[model samples]
Target: MAPKTIIQQESLLQYQCELGEGSLWDAVRQRLYFVDILGCKIFTYEPSTGKHGYQSFDRNVTALALLEDNTGLLAALQDGLAFISFDQLPFPPTNSPSTYKRLNVDITHLEGFNRFNEACVDPSGKRWIVGTMMHEQGFPGSAGGGLYSISKSGDGLTAELLLDQLTVSNGMGWTKYNKTMYFTDSLRKEIGKYDYDIDTGAVSNKVIFSNVDDEELGVPDGMCQDDQYGIWSARWGSGKVIRFTPQGEIDLIVHLPQALNVTSCIFGGPNLDELYVTSAREGTTAEQIKRHPSNGDLFVVKGLGFRGKERTRFQGSFLA
Candidate 1:
């Protein structure tokens, strides 16, 4: 096996965020879009100009995916999934939802599902999201809480049980070749891979792909895949991310400077060789908050590679 490594180049600067979690690579706009749920904000990183822009949300802005058109966004707002524009999202690039009531209809009913933890779009355009019962990695699962999905149409969304119980449903990635779907229930210390049926967006035949039993080292959180089929999982308590393959093969692990609960990672920079990471500090003590000053910050490492396509929302499969 190849040894663990870090990419050595950076084309942009690291920015501190309050609770940075989701890291979406916007291929159309050539920017890194992420959210700080506890801070209730959205951030846009423009590498070309070194400009970091932000928008504050009313509740939590959990996850974000760019529409196929490249100019809009599919936001997993605290209220629900909204065809939103942050600057002016729904339509007209000017009309915005003023109240949680007027926000995405789906969320209006499921706001209680969770603050919306992590999500990914399937090949059919359905939005698959997990409501973190615990919300935070180490916390316990909320009763009756689990996974959910919003159909491709503009109408109905459904809450289903991917698992009866879960703490943080974070790691989600399509395989390098797009044949498998890997998901992590962070507190379970288990990473699972399911047989993915792209045509129907159904997942089944799940088998454990990796298991990290050390509570002190933390369980798995968000992750990304590379062309070599490497699964780099961010360990929520260990202050490191590890690599595994689709068949449950261990590859390597890269350590971070502190255990601020690494949240998610993605390959975004030019050439898809730079790995960007998101960290969190929502539950830290005052002392911990000070010791790991980079907590809830954005970090990057050079010299890694991935072949992931920005996923598409079926409705907006308008092809950007």
Candidate 2:
């Protein structure tokens, strides 16, 4: 086997989070957005000005995507989905009460311990694919969660179940042409590729694309695709961001020395050349925390000679 390409990463911010998971880059706003699922916070950072801000929520804000109109954000909260207007938020973001327009998705059945996890808008921008996972410890053995696709239904939104009995539905992404979809089941340590129907938002023909069998390499978490068709996956317990070729072969790995639970990553920057990563400090013992002081901080990997295409924004209307 050929020598693996290695890349080094640096911490982007000093503000640590308990479980930083979702990483998104708003190309139009030129800002990076991420979430601390356990912290119930959504964070925004502007690379040009070095401005960082975050807004706290009463429940877990698992994932989010920009609206097509650029009016605001569509977030996956603990129990359901909500639309949040950017203009209504404080510039520097605070714990102040903000308004939320909840979508019509009844997830009460999965309440209690299960919460929404990773989410991504389809290439058509008309549908959003999201997953749910049990959040409690020792819950991996229970596969009570599922995956759903949310889209516009009349004047409101509707969620349709696509897959069931999922233990931990984590990362999700699409191939350049939208002909294939990639999904991660963390506990299973496998990334599955499926036949994607962009026009109808249908997924089928599931096949294992990459399986991480090494215990030390960790499981796959959140992921994003580059312009060159490479999938960049964050390894949860290994503190690494790995790039997998379209053929599901590992070609590059970015190491984060200050972090252990690497959660998610996205491509951002003025030219979309930088990869922004998120890590978690949750479940870490005091000794582990002492060893990896920046375990929960956001990180960036630059000069990778890779670029990411602009992410599709949610096209569904929020007006009721």
Candidate 3:
């Protein structure tokens, strides 16, 4: 058996977001874009220049995907998906809710749930796979939240429901070859894999990819797949991110004692070899908060010597 490697984490940013999630790396801009779900903010950080800024919103901005042309962003807001632009990023960030134009996509049929929790792009880049969560007080997946998808066609954008029973639809990822899809339902404490169709963006044959049901490991949250087909999952309340192989074995474990409410993670940095993690201080206790003052800060894990797959941009032009 190959010796297990313990990955060490370092603090990347000190800005503690209440419920930080959705870590997306904009390769063209050499920046990382993430959201503070409860803080109702969108943040962008440039690792090389150490430049950081954020824009606040009236509703929670749970997740975001880069537009194909790089002209704007598609954000999963509390009410619905909206289009946003970063053309004004060089200036100080703003707290203007009017900055986003809501997309026509509707989820009123789901009733009661107000926001999406995580999102990912299909291999063709023409479709978006997004999952939802109940913003109000309740257990994670108890709000009847589900998985849905939206695709851009020559006519316009269309929305469709895939899975309808979920509480916290969190981390999402796909294999580099686009042959498999992995989704995380934090409340369920399991990662589900589906046989994916690249041409049609259809997913079927769902199976349990990994189960993190153990209390000591915490709940499974946001996740990203490495180049080697290893899935890296952030364990909420455990302060650790674990790598699981296709054979269902724990390949690696990266820990950040400074934060136990790790919310999400993504592979970024100039080389795409760095793993950036975002955490939360939302439900942390006073004593725990005092001990790990960096509880909600961002972290980075490096030196494992592996790169991640290139991120696919959303091909929709809704902003235009």
Maximum-lDDT candidate = 2
User: Tens digits of per-residue lDDT for model 1 on 1-320?
Assistant: 67555432221334556667788887656778788888876677777677775665677878776655554566666546655543442211122333322233333222224456777776555555444444343345343336665554444445544444556567777775557888887667888888877766667888888886876446787887776767888877656777776667666666665546778888787666667788887767889866666767777776544554444544543211
Ranking the candidates on TM-score from highest down gives: 2, 3, 1
Residue-pair clashes per candidate, as listed?
5, 0, 1
* CA lDDT of every candidate: 0.64, 0.84, 0.80
User: What is the TM-score (0 to 1) of candidate 2?
Assistant: 0.94
Ranking by lDDT: 2, 3, 1
Residue 231, model 1: lDDT of 82
Could you tell me which residue pairs clash in candidate 3?
A: 141-167
lDDT of 3 by residue, 1-320 (tens): 65265645457888888998899899898888888889888888988888888877778988889888888788887767788877634434655444777777644436547567788887788888888775566454346677887887564567778776677888888876789889988877889988988887777899998876777578999988777878889999988888887666886788787788888888998889999999999998999898767878889888867787667898867646
Taking all chains together, each candidate's TM-score versus the true structure is 0.81, 0.94, 0.92
Candidate 2 on 19-48: residue-level lDDT in tens? 998898988888888998988888889998
What TM-score does candidate 1 reach?
Answer: 0.81
In model 1, the clashing pairs are 7-302, 7-303, 84-89, 85-89, 125-314
| Native-to-model Cα distance after best TM-score fit, residue 79 in candidate 2, in Å | 0.7
